[model samples]
Target: MKTINRFFVVLAIALLLSNTSTIAQEQTRPEFVTITTMHWNMDNKDFKMEDWKAVEKEFLDKITMKNEYIAASSFYLHRMTPDNTEVVYVQSYPSWEAIGEAAKRNAELAKTAWPDENARKAFFKKRDAYYSPMHSDEIYATMPNAKTMTAKPTKDMICYVRKGHFAYGEGADEEFDATSKEYFDNVTNKNEFVKAYYPMAHAWGSDRTEFLEAFFFDSMADLESMFDRDTELFEAHWKDEASRKSMGEKGAKYFDNRHGDYIYTYVAGLAK
Candidate 1:
C-alpha cells in the first residue's frame, strides 16, 4: 500500500511539472505585430512620388535591413478606400520588448546611413513631406495558429483585413475562441484560395477589445474567388439554414457590431 501511494504521488508531481512547463511556453510565445496607418500629404506641391520612393527605398534598405529586432516588415497601399492616399506599414517582432529595441536601432541606423547632420535632416524632411501628421497605431499579439500556405514571393499580394471588437462576458472569450478555432481548422484551413492567413488580438493598443484577421491572396482575382468559396464552406459546415442562423447568432453575440474591412496591395520591395 505504501509503494502504491508513493507511485501515485510521483505521478501527481510529474503532471504538475508538465502543466507548469506548458504555461511557461505559452507565456513566451514569440510573435507580436505593430500596424500603423498614415495618409499621404497629396496636396503638398513639392511632394513627388519618384523622390519619395527613393527616400523610402533608402529607409528600407539601410534602416530596416540592419534592425535585428525586426523579423519582417511590409508596406501596403490601400485599395478602394474612402481615403485614396492612405498607407499601412506593418512590422513583426519576436517579442513585445523587441518593438522598442527595433525603434532604437532604426534611429541609430538612420544616423549611420546619413552621417552628415545636414544631409540627414534633408533626407528626413523629404520623407516627412510624403505623409500627413495624422496617423493611428495599434499593437497586436499574433496568434499561434497563423499559417503561411505559399512561398514568399517578390511581388505584390492582396491583403484583406477584418477588424472587430468583442463584448466581454464570463466565459465568453473561451467560448468564442473554441468556436473560432473550429471554424479556422475545419473551414478556413481547408480553403485553398487564401495564400496565407493570420489572426491577431489587441496586445498593447488603444482598443483593448479589438480582434483582427487578415487574409492574403496572390492577386485580386484570387481574392474574389476566396469570397465565393467562403460562402460555400459556411453552408457546408452548417448544413441546415436554421443551424447556420443559430451559429451566426451565437458568434454575433461575442462581438460588437462595429467592424472595418480594408483591402491593400502589399509592396514587395518595401517588405523585409
Candidate 2:
C-alpha cells in the first residue's frame, strides 16, 4: 500500500508538468489573421481629402493605437493613374477568433470616447464611405520554411501590390485560373522574396473583374530584384521570346485595362 501511494504521487506530478508545458507551448506559438476592408472612394461631391486625412490623424489613429488585439494596420492609396480609387486600409489580428472580440472592445471604447450614440454612428458612417461595398478576408498559415524579413527599426513594412486581370471570353475564368496555376508553379514557386500573395475579386461597387492578386514584400529594393529574377524565370520556362510575349499578350487581353499596383507602409500597431 505504501509503495503504491508513492508511485501514484510521482505520476500525478509528472502529468501536471506535462500539461503545463503543453499549455505554455500553445500560448507561445505565433498565429495571426489579417482582416482586410475594401471600400470605394466617397462619391459625395463635397468630399475633401484634407478632411479625410484629419479623421485618420485624429480618430482612426487613436483607436488603433489603443487596440491591443491589432497587430498592425496600413492605409494604401492606389498609385495607378486611371484607377484613382483609394484602397483604404488593411489590419491584422493575433487570431481569427479574436476578430469579433476586438470589434466589440473597440465599440465599447468608442462609446466611452464619444458618449453620444448618434455622434459615434456618424463618425463610422463617414469612415465606411471610404471603402468599397464588399470586402472579404481569408486566413493564411505563414509558411514555416520561407525566409522572413526583419521588421525595420522605423516600424515600416513595405507592401507590393500585384494585380492580375482575368482573360475575357466564354472560358475566361478557366483560362485565368490555368494561367495563375502556371504562374505559381513556374514563377512564384522559385521566387524567395515573395512574402505573401492574396487573390481578390470585384464583388460590388467596382466593375466585374475576374481576379486581383496582392503580393507583399519588406522593401522597394526587393521589388526591383523581383523584375530581374522573374525575367530570368520567364526566359528559362518559356524557352523563346515569342512564347513569352504571346503569354503576356494573352493575359493582358483578359482585362478592360492594365492591372494596378500600390505601395504602402504597414502601420506599427497593426503589423505582426
Candidate 3:
C-alpha cells in the first residue's frame, strides 16, 4: 500500500510539470514581420508613374483593407542611401501562418479587381514594369520591449534602420542584454527627437543572428536632429569620454564591425 501511494504522488507531480512547460511555450511565441525591398526598373521607358501609383492604390485601398490576416502594411522610400530608387514594403503578422493566408487573400483580391483575364494580364504587366525583377526578402521577430512615443502616427514619419550582425556566445547574451538595457533606459528613452524605436532579431534570412533597429522621426530634418541629440544624451549619461569609450568597446564585442544603415520615409496613407 505504501509503494502504490508513492507512485501516484510522483505521477501527479510529473503531470503538473508537463502542463507548466506547455504554458511557457505558448506565452513565449514571437511576433513575425516580413520585409521586401525592391527598386524601380528605370530602364523600362514604357513605365508610367501614375499607372504604377494606381496599382499601389489598389493594394492599399482594397487588398490590405479586405484582408483580415494582414495586421499592418506600410511603404517606404529610400532616403540618404546609395539605392535612391529603392522602395520598401513591410507587413506585420500575428504568426507565420498568417503570412500564407495573407498571400492567398491578396491573389483573390487581384482577381476580383480585374475580372477579365486579359485585363488582369495587362494590369499586372504594367505594374511589374515599374519594379525590378530582383528584390530582397527578410523575416524578423520583433522584441516585446519596443518603445513607441505614440500609438501610431497620423502623418508620414521618417524611418532610419540600422542592422548589425551578432557575434557573441550563449553565456554572453545576458551580459550584452544588461548593457544594452542601460543604454536604452538612459539614452534612447530620454531622446525627444526620436518618435519611436523598435528592436528586432533576424528569425529567417541569410544572416540568422542579425539585430535590426528602426528609429522613427517626424521629418527628414528630424533625422539629423535625432543623431545630434543622441550625441548629447550619450555624453550626459556616460558622464565622461572614458566611460563612453568603454561602453562602445563592450557593445562592439556583441556585434560584427560592419553594419548596414538605410533611411526610409514611412507613408501613413499607404499603410493598413
Model 1: lDDT of residue 78? 79
Specify the highest-TM-score model's number.
1
- lDDT tens per residue, model 1, 224-249: 78766766776677678787566555
Worst 10 residues of 1 by lDDT: 8-17
C-alpha lDDT values of all predictions: 0.71, 0.51, 0.69
Q: Which scores higher on lDDT, 1 or 2?
A: 1
Give per-residue CA lDDT, model 3, range 55-137, as digits (tens): 88776776788887887788888777878989899888878898999899988987897889999888778778888999999
Once model 1 is optimally superposed onto the true structure by TM-score, how far is the C-alpha of residue 228 displaced, in angstroms? 1.9
In model 1, pairs of residues that clash are none
Regions of model 2 farther than 4 Å from truth: 1-30, 35-37, 80-88, 145-158, 162-222, 229-272
In candidate 3 the C-alpha lDDT for residue 150 amounts to 67
Provide TM-scores for the models. 0.81, 0.50, 0.78
Put down candidate 2 lDDT per residue, 1-272, tens digits, no spaces.
Answer: 22221111111111111133432454432244343545565565667767766666556555766778766556655543344564546655566576677788787778877789998889888876666687655443221112234443344446665443433443244454455456556665566666655433433334443334455566778866766666566567778767765666545544444445556544433322
Stretches > 4 Å off in candidate 1: 1-30, 46-50, 170-174, 240-246
Candidate 1 scores a C-alpha RMSD against the true structure in Å of 11.2
Q: Could you tell me how far off, in angstroms, the CA of residue 136 lies in candidate 2 after the best superposition?
A: 3.5
Please report how far candidate 1 places residue 119 from its true position, in Å: 2.3
